[model samples]
Target: MGDNTLALAGGNDKKWSDITSQESTDINTPVSFADTKVKNVIGYDNNTETNVRVATIEDYENLRDATNREFAYGVLYGDGATETMESIEDVYEYYRIENGGRGYPESNRGMRGCFVFNTENGNNLFFPIGATGYGQRRTEHAWYGETQLGAGRLQYAWRNEEYKKKDELGYRPLFLDVYRRPGAIYWVRTIPTNPTNKNKKYCFLDINYFTFDFSPGETEPTLGTGTSACFIRCVEEIP
Candidate 1:
């Protein structure tokens, strides 16, 4: 069963036929992104204003330690109840162009600049890497288990050249979420081992106290991976 979306093998397809042939799926079963909503919903965006509750380094660290998953801030302008789009570019734009480049008030960061301050030491911070487009297409194709470059057809705003310049100057910021409902599946930055594989990865924060990954279970048993319309929720980091 290949991923029909990219006309390539799916993740599950490869899972059954292991390269090492050891059936390693059970080796390290991934834990879901834990569900721990920090009370960082700072404010509501009327137009382009970012309204995220700032989390201290302690706050975030505590959350990560407790859940084993990092916290994702909310980009407040999009329709939280639904997905931005099926295409990665469209989803990225929802936060970049539509959300005013995540432009927030200086008060949020005490005039230094927008940042996810590392509360542990209280001296470190990071900028948003951009909304990762887990959706990928083969810019070129190769056999299974081989390395191939696939253009995800998406670009993160933080990776933009201008943003890079600003980052050099220290005006860096971080990223966040989509979906209004607690248990609804939303997009996060992730994909399976093979880019050409169609069984794309998605995420959700269950109200039951854990965050988990999801994907299209099975394709048509066809030769290629399956592509389905999905949702988007951005992520940010330091390293």
Candidate 2:
């Protein structure tokens, strides 16, 4: 009758014996369960059969709500390939379904809304700017280019000499893993406060050949062709 105890149903002697012998725990020992509800817990990689302490969509949203920055996650098309705004919306909608179908609202605790970056980030950012989302607009109009670099995400991926713990990166002022291919170029919305060209509206971060390079005056944003995708993981003021 215990939560972790699974009683053998009507099964043959051999199969039941095999399953129970390995999975069964001592009733008297009292197995320790997760502190929170199993469903509430994050970082469960079923494939790996281990908990990966990577940031979930909820983590991204929490970071966004607390700090007004948009934690964009997607593959930006750069190399000659092009996609429209509608396509991006489709991709985002698919992403929502994949990440647990619009998780319980932080305020309501269970109400689900078609929450978008505009709703969380508090800006009508999904407008026609060729492609991309509201983070670009918010970065341009407000925040004034105070976004964190993509390298900021990697800071938590491993335990370095400075950060002995993996979770330690989460405590930093701004932590995000706008994960993408190493060689692919990614977009950074921070418009140069003093750009060489005043007409340029967007800037980009190039992560290729094991080097981090920032390029100003990117009139057009692209994430290459095929599976090469870009992510927009930035930081904002912690509200």
Candidate 3:
């Protein structure tokens, strides 16, 4: 089958006629085909479906093996309230399994892991591969703050003590995340700036040290006056 075609027994989408035979089977179970595999691993959701497992290639730049007992945490930022580190790990592992327990997918192709970040100006930032690729680029930290966006494992970002200088900054981050290879341990990039900085980016800043605010207007206002409005652009993934 092609790469897009998920090798599921019943396939990803099953038409009504494919399963509405009205057979007196277990209705509660997701209508999937039974497997005769040797080792059936139970998923967190009590799912018995044999996940398609793929092997992870251990390279100095891509995948790193982890301890079976030890757990890795992540500092999540861009994810909304829904996706957490534990949930991300669950999805990560699920894909690994779907690829035959190998963390690497068989049809590996490089695509920019970018996202669209709208700027105050009439432009857009196509940040391909947000932190994941950035983490892979940096060589400083072994674990970036991307793990907290995992599945529902833990949420420590809301804690005041975890965040540094909370009184001044207004957010508290109490956890760390492994950015991963093809990733980084700690991925810190900078906010885009105008030509005023001469293209020198303000990357890898300690977010705990900055303050953020968004003030909009009909047109850009001046820096210091009653009607004058200024927007200081800053972003942090931690609490």
Candidate 4:
């Protein structure tokens, strides 16, 4: 018989409809079909049929291997890059071009330079070394702060003092060549509770130090003044 064809008892050829006919006798007990194999089991959910399969040992191994793999630092990522980063100079050159030649002495510190690090969940997170002035946290409202920054994990770390000691959090440089200067001020995605003037205070990080204000040294930036703006590094996940 052909692989696609089926034969029933007494050597009679039968179609799928013939086998499932209402007149057919029902077999309640388990009946094994010889030489039958299936890659996935059929199931139903929410009135919908689905194909379900358990993970094989190879699947688990592949996941473990992917999780354990380390990311090569200074590697060029994103669209149309052909080479791997070979040196710190290469990283700096890439940074300069991306930053429009703005460097440390400029107000755009760390804004344009891109770096990547791996997370515990095996995601490659790409982020800038500096903050951007475009999406400045305009309100001191804590909820607004969290929603605007869109970095809940980072905000939690900043509030709980996790960044100071946790190297895996990506606040500190994972690779030696990835430059992040000490004492550089950056904004956190949180606004602390201050019943006195909640609208005036916003949180920021001075690398190892943490505080709230409109600017680094000042109590608050003049409302409508852009001085409250600080580097806001948003993270992107690479597939």
Candidate 5:
């Protein structure tokens, strides 16, 4: 059961034609970029003007608390979504998890996990650093468990990287959904884990707002991390 897309030995090979009975990707291809463009929809006017919204206090907090750089984030913003939490974080392990490097090269941090801001403490460190299965009745297995890496202490598996390959673009994506809002202004962070190491620097986003758009369950999985990744103070007007 490998991710046939990259020949990875885990995800299964489910043919697209088998599922849709189509031989070509013509139907799947988007015909018009303008049709999917986010314009006045999020607060945009026409092509020349925009009605961008100002940032609010909560927006600021969410921005400060979120990670500016991105390793693996949700394609959308909900549960059971296409690019869910479990799936996106895998993006981190591939690029950042090279041998003897900045990431968990020693694989000590555990398995496919995530980091998110929890509170606004004075020192600003109320983040969740445990398993993706914190509490409640939810739990999940690593995308590439012992199947990929040896069965080391998998308890803290959430902390370590997940893949051993790169994405389609060679470089990982920085923002999760930065282009959601056309006129509304909101952003997270992209702090470098090692300020001195420029190559390992990455972006972490804190907020996402899509005024007139609807992704439904697109963002569920990426956000399904065991804990909250952003502080998300508000979702309303700035003033």
Candidate 6:
């Protein structure tokens, strides 16, 4: 009659002994529960005050696989305000329709390949594979300089001092694909350290046929000069 006890017909109480004999012989044997059991475990959600489906190991594996695929293609999802790595084809279709049906151009399509460079202050930093150039003389100036204005810009953008140092030593990120264009020069955000005329020199990447020339100490051209028309490579942050 107690709440924990189960009563059968004729007011008889049932216990584990009564059900043990009825159970299949295979029940006692140790068998694999890979797919047959624990498919969808239900748990109560305190915040929503409802029952929610709990994620299993399989669910985590699927998510990790999907994320790897997204990272490979640099696919992004979400509205303009927010973005995440999911629903690749849907976002691509939306982007294609929004951009006058032209989608992305071939030369600049490499920009779509983005990978997480690092995480700082709870935000993820991503660097695109391709670079973009500002029109006219604007492209000549390094966005960050050795002057007071550009002093902390590199640290602010990249956040990790060690990675910046590695970058200065021509360290290429493993996630980035080999740039299609060889002998291409691009402007990096890091400012070179020059005791004399600090504002005049800025760090630029002289990408050679097989390797990167990332020496920040070497001087290139003065800022705002028309001769240094280097493509601008940018790093973006996402929360």
Pick by TM-score: which candidate is best? 4
What tens-digit string does per-residue lDDT give for candidate 5 at 1-239? Answer: 11222222233545212222112223223121111221332222234433333233334444444654222222222222344234434422222243332222222222222223334442322222223322111112233232222221223222234343565224344322222221111112212233455343222222222222111111111112232122211133223
Residues 1-239, candidate 3: write the lDDT tens digits.
01122233434653222322112223222122232322333332333434332111111011112222121232323322244434443323222224444233332222222222223333332222222233111111112132222211122121212324437344334222211122211111112232454344322211110112111111111121111111111222122
For each candidate, C-alpha RMSD in Å?
A: 19.7, 23.1, 23.7, 25.2, 19.9, 26.8
Span of 10 residues, lowest total lDDT, candidate 2: 134-143
Where model 2 places Cα greater than 4 Å from the true spot, the runs are 1-182, 190-194, 210-217, 221-229
**Judged by lDDT against the true structure, how good is candidate 6?**
0.30
**C-alpha positional error of residue 124 in candidate 5 after TM-score superposition, expressed in Å:** 18
Tens-place lDDT digits, model 6, residues 1-239:
11234444344775322322111223223122122221121221122222223232233223334432322234333233243434433333332222332323212112232343222333332323222211111122333343322211111111112224445446455313232222334454434334566454434443332232222223442343223333444322223
Model 6, residue 6: distance off in Å is: 85
Worst lDDT 10-window in candidate 5? 213-222
Taking the candidates one at a time, how many backbone clashes does each contain? 17, 12, 47, 3, 34, 0
Every candidate's lDDT: 0.27, 0.27, 0.23, 0.30, 0.26, 0.30
Candidate 5 Cα errors over 4 Å, as ranges: 1-37, 42-62, 65-194, 203-239
lDDT of 4 by residue, 1-239 (tens): 11233544344775322233111122222122122223321221134333333322233224335544443322233232455544544333332232332222221112322232345655653323322212232222122123322221112121222233455445444322211222233553333433455443334433321211112211232222122334543222223
Using all chains and alpha carbons, the TM-scores for the candidates as numbered come to: 0.19, 0.21, 0.19, 0.25, 0.18, 0.24
Better of 4 and 5 by TM-score: 4
Model 4 stretches astray by more than 4 angstroms: 1-76, 85-90, 93-120, 130-185, 194-202, 205-228, 233-239
What's model 2's overall lDDT? 0.27
Name the lDDT value of residue 201 in candidate 1: 29
lDDT accuracy of residue 186 in candidate 4:
50
Ranked by lDDT, the better of candidates 2 and 5 is: 2
